[model samples]
Target: MLYAYLLSVVRTVAPIAAGWLITQALRLGVTIEPGPVESLVTGAFAALYYAAFRFAELKLSPRLGWLLGWARPPEYPRT
Candidate 1:
């Protein structure tokens, strides 16, 4: 549980970092300016994106692990 929780934090921070990276990229490529308000809004967007990603990952991780052969099946006793 704690591992998952911490992972979620990373999940949350990843989008924020990605957003900053995007802003940097856009600043380099285009003349569009980002204001303080937009930065705050982008932070919110990043948080939301992180939350959704975490939720989705939680929902899908088990299935993905099984598909990837990382999940082991339970052993059955012979009748």
Candidate 2:
């Protein structure tokens, strides 16, 4: 579903975005340049982290059901 796709994209991008912000902050105080290679590595690591997180969530869903309360309920369940 659209929601799932959006969540996946957010999860994948969040760490890379955070890394970029942190690097920018450090650059203000230090002479550090995260060039294209660093960006690519960061993005690759972010995707790996997202995949691991999603795998864990799916594997543990039964015990983590409470964390997923935001999902839509069955359409016919409510009166």
Task: Assess every candidate by TM-score.
Answer: 0.35, 0.39
For model 1, name the residue pairs that clash.
none
Error of 2 at 10 (Å): 0.2
Tens digits of per-residue lDDT for model 2, 1-79 = 6776797999989989998997997789965566966987898898787556556556755344334443322243322
Give candidate 2's whole-model lDDT.
0.66
Candidate 2 at 31: error in angstroms?
Answer: 12
52 in model 2: Cα distance from truth in Å?
8.5
lDDT of 1 by residue, 1-79 (tens): 6776797999999979998997997889955457966987898898687656555546766444344334543354543
Leading candidate by lDDT: 1
Model 2 / residue 67 / CA error / Å = 18
Q: How high is the CA lDDT of each candidate model?
A: 0.67, 0.66
